[model samples]
Every structure is written in C-alpha cells, then in structure tokens.
Target chain A: MEHSSTVAGNPVHDNHGGTKEIWRTFWILLGLTIVELVLGYIMIGVESTGGRLGLKGAIIILMLAKAFYIVAYFMHLKGEIRNLVMTILVPLSLLLWAIIAFLYEGHSYRNNRNTYDAYTRERSNIQSTDKKADEKGMHEKKRTGAETME
Target chain B: METTTAGLDTKWWNGGKSPFNVEYGKLMMWYFLMSDSFTFGAFLIAYGTVRFSSNGWPDPNAVFKSYPGASETTNAPLVFVSIMTFILIVSSVTMVLAVHAGHERNKKKVATNLIWTIIGGLAFLGCQAWEWNHLHHEGAWWGSNPFANSDGTESTDNFTNFFFTITGFHGFHVLSGVVINIVMLVMTLLGTFEKKGHYLMIEKAGLYWHFVDLVWVFVFTCFYLL
Candidate 1:
C-alpha cells in the first residue's frame, strides 16, 4: 500500500509477515480489552466504591495506551516521517488540553450545584417542619419550668 | 533501500517523483482521516465533559446492558458491544488480508477477502441496528430521554443525546465504509486496478476500513467500558 516509502520485498511489509503483524496487534488489543473488563468486574465485586476515582484513572490510562498502539501500528503511523507525525500529534494534544479545561470547569459547576442543593434542602426543611418542632420544644420547657434557650 | 549511507535519501523528499514520500491518493486519504479523527474526538470529548459534570450520570454498565434476544433487565455490561467490537476487528483483519493479496497481485484472493470484509461490515451494521432498536425500546432516542427504564435510574438528555449522536455518527461512517468497500470490490472484480498496474486502490480502501475499526475501539472504551 505504501509503495512509495515501502520496499517491495521488505519482510514485515510483505506477504506472511504483514498478516502476522495484523493478527499480533489484534491479539494484543483483544487481551488489553479483556483485562480492562475483568478489572472493572473485580472492582465492582469487591465493593470498592471508595477508590472508584483511582480505578477510573487506571482505566483511562489503559485506554490511552491501547489507543496509541492502534493508531501507531494499525494505522501505520509509526514508520512515517517525524514531520507527518507531528502534524497529527500536535493538534491532538491541543484537543486534549481543550477537553481537560472543559472537564475541570464542568466538575466545578456540578460541585457548586450539589452544594446549593444541600443548602436549599436544609432551609426548606427548617421552614416547613422544624418551625413546629421548635414551638413544641418551647411549650414543653415552659411547663417544666426550664428557662427558654436562645 | 531508499535510504543511503550518504546520510539521507533526498530524492523522494524533494517531492519530485513522490511528494511527501507517499502517493497523492494515499496522502490525501491520510489527511482526510486526520481531520475526521478530530471530528470524532471532539464529539467524544464533549460527551466526556457532560458526563463528568452530571452528578447523576447514567452508568455505561447499566445503560448499555442487554444482548439480542435477551430481556431488558439483564445486567451484563458490554456483552453485545464486545461482540460488535469483535466483528469490526475481524473485518479489519480481512481488509489487511485483502491488501496483502493486492501486494501479491492475486486478484482472486483480493476479491475474496474484500467480499468477506463487506460481509463483516454489513453484519456489524445489522448489529448496530439491533442494538439501537433495543435502546430505543428502553426510551433512548434522538432527542428525548426516556425515564421509564426498569431500574428507575436518573437520566438526562445529555448522556442519552451523546449516546445516540456519537454512535449514530459512527454508524454513518460504517455505512460509508461499507459502500466504499463495495465499490472497491467491484473494481477488483472488473480488474480496473489491475489495468492500472497496481492494486494500491484496494490498499487505500483498506486504510479507510482499518480507520473505521480504530475509531470503534475508542468508542467502545468510552461508551461501553467506561
């Protein structure tokens, strides 16, 4: 396929070697994917919700490594010139940076929303039910001859 | 060897015989695919941001559960999708075989491998359709997020929207790749590339087919595994 850069009789680029290389990558990808799934199941079974964030990070790292192999070998980008490689990599890195920024901003918003929800729920409960409960406590105190607390 | 003891091969680098050290068609295809990658990347990144933002984001394990002919309440994560992934990967292997056949100028092998790839691609598309129907029955759609799934899990338009959009976009790519494979297969049978003295056309189509497979790996990780 890449006849311009690839020699006609190169071992790995020629007949059996080419197919063998393809199968090898396929196995590696399949194995990595299976490992990812098994780890997910184990974490779920162990009830390790406390370390879920760590597990998520590990999973993502594995995903990135897999992505690299697929692109480098399956796409045949590994043997390309440095310039062509940079042309693809630089933009991808920039994309990653943009995504990271968005993720950070989004997480912050969710945190704020959760905090707001807690505060609002607290205030609403106090208004609707805590008011009557407070009066009942004051009346009991009056009958028992105890001083009313502020 | 194209490279020499003189330190470098300046002949191809000069863009005289082969500019960019790759054929014009192949180079253009790579360029197209690079841009296409950014498009898909952008969609997945957007999905990630929205997912991480939501406190009640639906779990992929729960959301994507269920295989064909299975009840809706089944809890197996990635079972169906794993099969889909396997199919796409097998199609990619067949495409590689086709390119190998081209290298050997075995027109029969090339045509046969291509037909196999086409069958694989079509099977994958059918799988996607089946999966989508199951999802649609469970209340996932183009715009509306159905809250009626059995578990009473909290869902929003964000996750479901991305689910439909990203996979639909990828399904569209599969459709296009299948069409392209059919074209390449026809040309192989007609011996068009043979007359041109090279089966590089098959190799070029193979690149696109492989790329479609590569993108599915990411989609499977993000949408199914994670």
Candidate 2:
C-alpha cells in the first residue's frame, strides 16, 4: 500500500497555473477593488434610500467578486480537486441563513424599539449632544472620593 | 463482486490514499481557514445586526475622512482606506509569488518575495495604527463614540464598539500573518525546506496570509463603505 504522502507527491497534482495566472488574478482583484471604491464614492451623493441601497448592493457584489478571485487564484482553491472544493464551500453556505436570520431579527428589534421603547426613540431624535461633557461628568462622579485620598 | 470491488479500489478515497489528493497538513490548513472564516463571519454578521437595530448610524465618510499629512480640514473619505486596501492586495500578490517560488523550489525568489510581503504587511499595520490613533484622539473607542449619526441625531456607542472590535481583530490576524511569514523567511534562509525537500510550509503560511487579506475585503466594505 502506497503512503498518502506518496500520492500527494504526484507531479500531476502540482499544476497550479503558474505565475501568469497569479498576475492575472492580481489584476482582477485590483480592478474589482477599484470598481468597489468608485461605487462607494458615487454612493455618497445618492440621497434616495433605494439609490443608496442599490450602490451599496453593487459594492457588496464587487467585494464578493474580489474575495472569489483571491480564494480561487491566490489561495489555490480552484486548483484543488472537486471533492475538496465542495467540502470547503458547502458548509460555508450556512452563512446565508445566518445572515438572513440575524438581519431579520435585528430589523424586528429596531421596529419594536421604535414603537415601545420611548426612551430609545426620544434619545435618537435628540440633536447630537457633547459627548465629551458626558464623559467628563462620568469621570467627575468617579473621582469624587479619589480626590480626598490623593 | 470483483467488478464492484475494483471500482471501489480505484476511487480516490480507497483506504490507501488521501481523497483530497492533498497532504494532511495542507488539508488541515484548509479546514482551519474554513473555521476561521466562520469566526470572522460571526463578527461581521453581529456588526450588521447592530447596525440594523440602530435607528441611525454615523456616516463612514464623515468618520474616516483623514489621512496621513492631510490638513485637518481636508474632507476626503475612503482615500486612506483605499490605500490600505491596495497595500493589502499587493501584499497578497507578493505572497502568491512567494508560494509560486516555493513551488519552483527557487529559494532566492521565495526569500525576496517573502521580504516584500512582510514589508507590505507592516506598512498596512502602520496605516492601521495611524488611523486608530487619529480616531482615538477624536474619542472613538470600544465604549465611546464622539461622532453623530449622519442625520445629526444622537448616535450609539455600538458604532465605535463594533468598529474597534472587528478591525482590531482583523489587525491582530495581519500581525500574526507577518510574524508567520518572518518565521517562514527565516526557515528558508536556514535551508530548512531545502533539507526537507519541500516548501509546503510556505504554502500554508501563504494561505493564512491571503486569508487575512480576504477578511480585509469584507471589513473594508462593511465598515468603511457601507
């Protein structure tokens, strides 16, 4: 029986598309990042909720594209056998459910807060207060007894 | 029975071989990275949940508008972060080159690329440190947020809390990756792999380095852009 190491040593398994492929992946990743940045920049002036969400969605898609190139080319996952690829990726699909569930729950929580949590709603509506003053007041309260000891 | 047994024997998972056609170490590294991805996924998803639950959040453009040597009044956003993102991408490219050199058994190329990758990692860390320092001066920390919501309404500390925690975690990963690369470079210089007849260790390190870069892509999109 041949050892697994011997099987892994087969030169047939070592064809990982060489340096040209690496450079190509580099360019693709760089391009995707540039697109994402441009989309993000354009999103700044987008006022409508739908418009802003659309740009954010585009940026997210570009970000995922960048991730795909990095994983496929740089990490050499694309060169792996089909079984290996499936094993790594199939489990990752669970993240879709996790994301959807969490975001839904969070959205519901926000709705509940807005309706029932008067303090939260009131606080959120207030104009921005001087946070430094709040921090100073908290510090002052903490220092009341310490000053006498010092 | 003979035909069925023959088919089974020819399968990659026949008792004598690795079904993945990869050595145990590399396969384990892939599994480790998969698990690590979930960890980062959880952090980012939790961040998303918090943002969703909030009524309003700080505009990333307003918060991340400063860069090194820029005037305090300069109103550029996403500029410094874009540079940081490029540094990471370039470092990831160098890491691929290092791994490719490892494949060719070209020790000199491996060492040089590793050095470049290390430099890129450090430069990225330096940028993060500067950004963190700048934010710290403005009173953003784990439990404090000085910035207001985009609508000029009061904002919650969860903004800075998640930002510091997630990015801090990602920075820690980059720091470890640099250390791992330095170790690989030292081993290469010592001809450790030359004696062992393989640079598989460098390939593993490269996987880890690239994983750090991969996490940054999501982090940049989530915190800075969205």
Output the number of the TM-score-best candidate. 2
DockQ of structure 1: 0.15
TM-score evaluated only on chain B, model 2:
0.97
Question: Where in model 1 is the C-alpha error above 4 Å?
Answer: A1-16, A115-150, B1-19, B147-153
Docking class of 2: acceptable
lDDT tens readout by residue for model 2, B87-126:
9999999998988898889999999999999999999999
TM-score attained by model 2: 0.92
Measured against the true two-chain complex, the DockQ scores of the candidates, in the order shown, are 0.15, 0.49
> CAPRI band of model 1?
incorrect
Candidate 1 structure quality by residue, lDDT tens digits, A1-150: 435344433322334357788788878878877777776665555445567666667777877777777777766777666776777678677777878898898788767766777853343233222111122344343322222111
